[model samples]
Target: MSAGSVPWTDLDSLDIASLARRDGEKWAVAPSGVLPAWVADMDFPISPTIRQAVIRRLDTDLGYPAWFDESHGGPLGEVFARRMLNRYGFVAEPTHVRLFTDINQAMQVILHLGTEPGDGVAFHTPACPPFEDTIGKLGRIPRAVPIRLRDGEWQIDTDRLEDEIRGRQGPPCRALFLVNPHNPTGRVFRRAELLEVAKLAVEYDLMVISDEVHSDLAYPGYEHIPFASLSDEIAERTITLTSGSKAFNLAGARCAIAHIGVKTVRDAVDDHRGVLFGQVSALGVDALKAAWTSSDVWLEHVMAVLSRNRTAVAEQLPPEIGYVPPEATYLAWLDCRGLGLREEEPSDFFLREAKVLLNPGPLFGTEGTGFARLNFATPPRVLDELLRRIRGSLGC
Candidate 1:
């Protein structure tokens, strides 16, 4: 779709009352009249194509799904392979692509198949909670590599990362959990940065689980370099997990795809699909297919709205709050240390006084203690009210 044809208007214009009635976690988890800017799910409507596809499926009688067969890759796998090639120029064979209910499940499966208990999985600090949580639940150690904010830009401290890999306390570092267009920070990993990570993964003999779910949401002037797409060597050790869920507002749809470059890993995951990993819903599969194959126009429109909202958050937020406009995703990681709250977490303060809910920084990691994550994927009017609430609470 051309930029001009893309609908630049705010589509997520639900008022507080309308939002409360919806069943999304963003709304359901919040009390009545309180704005929910906490979760990563967008407040926007589902893409027309995806919605229609789901509706068509609902008309038919539900039955057992044709499970993803390893011999002949299913339609979802083929579509995902085509999407990777067309969007990111990544060459993925359909046979190597496996379907999952979501990225979280995919990660769990990878951890189970790739590493033994007590193994160390290294990921960047201030990461999305799920990454660390998954590691802990699987009886593994979480090795947090801190990302430093250097000269107003968030950067991976490669030296520190290498040191962490080399000087492990317990179990060997088995995997590197890489988030491209990283959550919270929204720093799109540059080609050079990705190559460095690839080098480290190869050197350390670490399995790379690259989460590129937000790769499609990157803003203009920044590009998301798929970690596995760097080289043949990197691909051999990588399992790239991605989905249209984040970009297309399909979280409830419960569908994700993992492009496995290693044959052994692929086989292990496939073998356990029904026994260890549950089957994906037929509706989710249909929605995913529609999203990847025919919803580019809708995605472009949503991106336009998100791009504008990103700017709005920067321009409208109080000067005391520090925000680096994200290069990808709808989340704006706000540094509230300068707000003079002293001991009070910014998220708690906002929720109590401003009646707006945000993800507290500390929840991401210790590095985010004075920070708060704001979901900017809402209507302009709602965003205005959100800013007003924050400003009023701060007495600005």
Candidate 2:
């Protein structure tokens, strides 16, 4: 797609609600109709199917939510499992699917059960800050391996990761934490890349914790290959965490599911479920079921819109910043090392001067310095304003 054909043209007319500069202030319509390209949430309204289901559920008297629990035989878990298996070609038993409030909680649960205080947990550098914080809070050392953009795609230095895992030799590298279709970078690791990483995990007897919240957002012709699908051995060692919040924009509902493929892994997760991750919300469970089973058309439309937006953003960005278009998700990681801004300063600069908020690269990791993470999920008009703000700030 030509950069010039980017969707910015249509986005020039949106009006976003404005918030107070400080907390506890009166909110009013943003007089300027500034675009909000900051948060991952989409500007487009919720899907009609999901909205109707929610409304219908509220109106109907479904007492006690027994449907969520297996005793009552609700198909929520089965629905998600089937969708995942069908899309990724990984077999997941509905019985093996356990509910969680969110993927972050699932990560904590995995950490609590799989590793000890100060145990080494491996992750790619420039990952979500929450990963590092979660590991630290759990008292595990977050060992980061960098994934650099080369040849228009992000690639992990497997040799470095393997060496680091092996060099630690004694601690045995307890777990490898990953974000397939990665967050800020938007680089979808190929199947071969996943296999090599899986091989290392098996060789070292390590757990693989993969956060695939953005899996469903993959664009046309690009498939999201679940890490578990790489091999049976890998499946045994892996815990896949995903949620409908991302693709469906249902994050506020707070529900995510874990698919534990191996008996040992399932047992491990279940054993600690009581202490760490508790029961999911009744609404979240129902929403997830509705989304996974009946939202294919909505999801396809979202993918198409985001694909167009991604191409648009790629076109507007200067080549010096070196960001290849993402294969999945609405996030775009733009390298800004050339822009003479401190790691944390540019995002703030854009927010203050350009009146646009963006995730600073530093928040992701040191490797993310001189980069900025963007959310392209807003309406086209808002997106145009965001690009204009960026262009003004950069004197482009």
Candidate 3:
């Protein structure tokens, strides 16, 4: 598939009838007439390069994989390191890279190894809902550092965050969960913002689990800086988590990578590698390896569509609803507090009235109240119809 053809034409040409027939969670979970835009998964098709790689792996071998030992320059480490170097100009070591089934699993494993129960974790809230849930289930307290909508931008209150970390006067927050190209709001941290976070981590002696799963999707003029790439001191205190799934639309492939820059956490995770943590499927490895190694041209195509769609969302959305076009990702966070619906909840209101399903704001944390996240990564016609439905529901 030529980069120009697949996204510009083929993606827009996709049939919703055909998409509904597929068993993926994005389309299937919704009722027959409801257009689902709640999930982060893109409506775009997987890259052909990834498909071929998975097929080849299935055709040849299904046995136990060789990279289980987490050796240096192993299946994912070298590939991940090379990708960091080529894509972001960050010099990462193959030896520090590790693999997991998905980002969630990677987080679980890292938290289990890095912190004990009852420790406090400082995370930017209105984040991926599950991160807060994970912190709770693992028996850790959550210190919410909310990024507020100020002056037409989603800016983190760095002062509030520092207070969350330092002013509590109890045990220091053991970990800081950093989500770059932030979810719900889709704000990409500029260099100055990242430096503030790094400074806080250093002052507080906090472990930073930098989640950059959406890093590859940052649009033009928005740069993603790996937290570990800041300085050797910060690197030693950070573990950067990311995946190719979001970029290539391969979430079903279920693979994620982490560069464990801190030696003690790495040693602890390595000491218990196979028994309780750190195992990835052979096919997942192959799929991601192919994606990282060869599917960037496909990504350029997808990014083009997303850039246009992001603009479309800003241009076509109902004037009553407040929306800020995301710096990265195909998701839009809509502020619908002004709508004055009977229920005053945008997701439920839209699902009932517009027949469009969106993720509720409160799921992302209290900061998400009066907000809803809309996935704009669908085919052009489908996206247009949905936006029309939304406008129609508003009686305008």
Candidate 4:
């Protein structure tokens, strides 16, 4: 709809036909012309400032990374804290900030530090797969509590969460993990709603891990409240992870940060940090710095593209697919229940029949079984073609 709003150029500009040209038939995922509308990655080019910043680092010949000791208490940390506070009115102390190579590592380290074997870890359902995987792989029992979708909106099931935490049968739940402006679903919890969750966490004596990686990409007028920011009590027991990767299309850069307010929690998490784990990519650091502090023009453009893409998705998809328009993130979570397709069916149908690639809903969790997560960050033209292919496959 507007310049720089969408991430990728049109599908026709892509080699979509070539990608799926099986005996000259058009396909979307052909080896030579694969249209990767599946993952969170944006096909757009990086900002000039980020590109230059990385190049500036490469000019140093990729030497051992300089110490980020200064960053822990530096202006960068202060800037981050202030920016978040200003945006969400949730004051976070700079002393609580800790840098990391990526959020995935941060999640793992926090899980390892805060939880013990056999402890129950509760996650709001329809979440990122890694949230569940990290717990199970670490020997903690994975407990998923569903979030209710009502009136074309998504809300956490605080009642169910409370029941599980206070229930007689389950083992003591030790931790609660949240994805604010949640993944796939793109549900940006309101401030009061987040406070309710924080209250539950406090009541249960559960440690909190709030992932706000997609917070910045939120659409106009929707506010993203960080669980840790609810109050000092919550902040002290919470670990918040954020990155410029998703919002700025810099996942390849692998730079992120975690803020832990409490001394005991921070120390415990720090104990697990290894030499390789916290090592920041020099280029990644530069790119993140450029992205966070600068590139407003590029970001504005990206947001515009995402807005059009989101609108297009709502208007174009068949009635069989259902979703509330998201408040943030380029990801669209579509309910395929009406299509009579299983959780994995949409992805399979798209790849084999439509020649497109999408993230299957089930990957997020079992609750996501009859849904599909689509990336609408591509150019409008490309998105149109994707819709065309999908419609053709559905014969609708």
Candidate 5:
């Protein structure tokens, strides 16, 4: 089915009151009557295909998943490999794909298997907090390579990144955590930029753990390049992590796939699965299969709504708020530094005054201070109300 066949307009008009009653963190964490624009999950419903698949599984087979079996070349791995090849032209060997409960678990397992505890891991600053948190929790040094907003574009400070790796004191930098269509900032990195990153990884002999959950959400004009797909040498050094959860609004399913190009690295992760990493749920396996095979239409429609919402933010927000419409994801990284509000963090002010729950910039990293991340994957009417509340609070 094509995106044109879906009732995108009706689906986009989600009922806020009903959403608030749901058990998800995005809605449940916010106070009563406050609009939640904090968590990464979307307010939209799961794809019909995914919903049907779950129901079908519950009705017939609630048994253990045969994900590890080699019959028909492994179900989950085959689906992932086919999707990668058909969608992105990236050739993923089915044997190299591994399943996990979620991306966070995948990261933890990858770190445990690939590098020593004291090794340093580098990633862009103002990043998804989990990347830094995971590194620190694993006894690894978290080296933040900052990205600067220059001329209204978020550009990676490549020279600074190289210097950070080279100037490491105690532990050697062993891996780089890359977020394509970067979170919070939402910069869909260009091909040239990805090539540079690949080159840097090769030069430093660093393993690249690329989180590409937002790859499917790139805007009409932007393209998402898989880091491992750049070249054969880079592929050998890259572990690409992705999931259906982000684009398909299936976070609750808790399913993620990791494409491990290196044989030894794959073996290391697989060996530690039962003890350190938990198994993927049977329902998660079904949802993933349905998502990769039949949910593109639903995803396309969601992207359209998100694109409209992004434009609304840019056109409607007051001059005091700095917003560059993101190239991917429903997240809008607002530069609240110019607001000059009495409060140090704009998110607090928004929550109290505007009655909107936004993610505090400081949570992402020091570089994220004086900013806020807003989830715009809401209905247009609700988003309009949110903007109105903010405008009223600003007295603009």
Candidate 6:
């Protein structure tokens, strides 16, 4: 059967040997016999449409692309605008969208254009580790706003964050890096919480850099609201970033787009296009366009698999390990602190004993201690084996 018609339970899994042979960081670093459930990358194959699009391009065009000269940002811009309008009820200007190699590169350029050195960027704790590191690398201080466990749910501590922005907790922050369907812990921010953040952004006049790469993965009951879509005022200051990578398993394609709503930032980026940055490859662009336009069925299957795996993780994991199956994403942010493992980072213990590699919690920030993030995007059989090994290791 075509991949689009394949049942979610029939997810094809690569054998350990084949997976390790791949060049991606997910499996390459792990030693033999280790089941790598680490990194944000998935173990599934790419959407058939994305693969075919790239192959078609290979057989056709091999020259420098001509669409780079467009004033309206070419096919990528149009695609983004159409998707935004269709997926969410947001009316986006095609001209406001800009393409980049990936979200990190887009973030770096946006940060350079928007803020001065030493300005603070406050984002949710247990944030994406590389993003936290990127703040430091850019000579900016990262102010952590913790997402605490309350009433058995992970929710943002908006009061504490507001205090930080107001200089009551620390120096007032200049920017707020918002990660919807937040990484590590997959609590998809509700509209009320988002409105609270919007109020903070408006009141504090902070630039909002929203990373919505996981927007497409918000689970059945939760909705992923675009921060910029809240209000025109919010949109003007928000630079929304997303990619086909997380949803379509196109991480290797290296394509991302940003909706630059702030006129000043947009103007600065427009001026520097190609001269400073913004040279997306033909392959990346084509693959992203196809993934966005032609691969809904593939995404639906992937989401179904993720939904089942999310439940499986919560039920199969040892009861001592704290876990709330996320409202979104294929990642399971496990609270291993309750287990009281000898290793400071629970990932280390899992790696050594269970032969399952996971992302260490401390890397996510001060709040990630004694936690570990597991990628559950592999097939059902593989995930079963992974959980079995972990259970055996724990003597549970």
What C-alpha lDDT values do all the predictions have? 0.85, 0.74, 0.86, 0.77, 0.85, 0.85
Q: Residue 149 error for model 4, in Å?
A: 1.4
TM-scores for all predictions: 0.95, 0.88, 0.96, 0.89, 0.95, 0.95
Deviation from native of the Cα of residue 227 in model 5, angstroms: 0.4
> Tens digit of lDDT per residue, candidate 4, span 1-396?
322232332322433333333221122333443455777866454677777788888886688665546336433477677778767787877777777778888888788877889888888889887778888999988888888898778888888888777643578788888888888789999988888888888788888888899998999988888887778888888988998888888776778878886577687755655564656677777788788777767778778888988999988988888978889998999888888754347788777778777888889888888788888876677788888888888997
What residue pairs clash in candidate 3, if any at all? none
Over 1-396, each residue of candidate 3 has an lDDT whose tens digit, in order, gives 322234433678776676666578988899998899988888777888888898999999899886645757468888898888887888998899887778899898888889889888999879888899998899888888889888999998899888888747555688999999899788999889899999999998889999999999999998988888898999999999998778877788778888999888888877877857647788888999998998888789889988988998988998889999899888999989898875678898899899999999999999888989999988878888899999989996
Taking the tens digit of each residue's C-alpha lDDT, what string does model 2 give over 209-294? 99999998888777789998787788887888998878887887888887766567667765665534566766677677788878
**Tens digit of per-residue lDDT, candidate 6, span 1-396:** 333344433575445555566677887888889999988987777788888899999999968888845458676988998888888888888888888889999998988888878788888888887897888899887788899999988998988898777766556688889999789788888889999999999999999999999989988888888889999999998999999889987777888999998888888887888757858888988999999899888888888888888889988999999898888888998888888777567998999899999998888888888889999988777898899999999997
Candidate 2 displacement at residue 312 in angstroms: 1.2
Question: Which parts of model 2 have CA positions greater than 4 angstroms off?
Answer: 1-14, 17-34, 67-75, 272-276, 342-344
Candidate 6, position 35, lDDT:
93
Displacement of the residue 197 alpha carbon in candidate 2, Å? 0.7
Clashing pairs in 1: none
Instruction: Candidate 5: list runs displaced more than 4 Å.
Output: 1-9, 70-73, 168-170
Candidate 2, 14: how far from true, in Å?
Answer: 5.2
Candidate 5 residue pairs in backbone clash: none
RMSD to the true structure for each prediction, in A, is: 3.4, 5.2, 2.5, 4.4, 3.0, 2.5
Give the CA lDDT, 0 to 100, for residue 65 in model 4: 66
Clashes of each: 0, 4, 0, 11, 0, 0
- Please identify which of the two predictions, 4 or 6, would achieve the higher lDDT against the true structure: 6
> Residues 112-185, candidate 1, lDDT per residue (tens digit)?
99898988898998999888988999998898998989888999999888877775566668888988889999
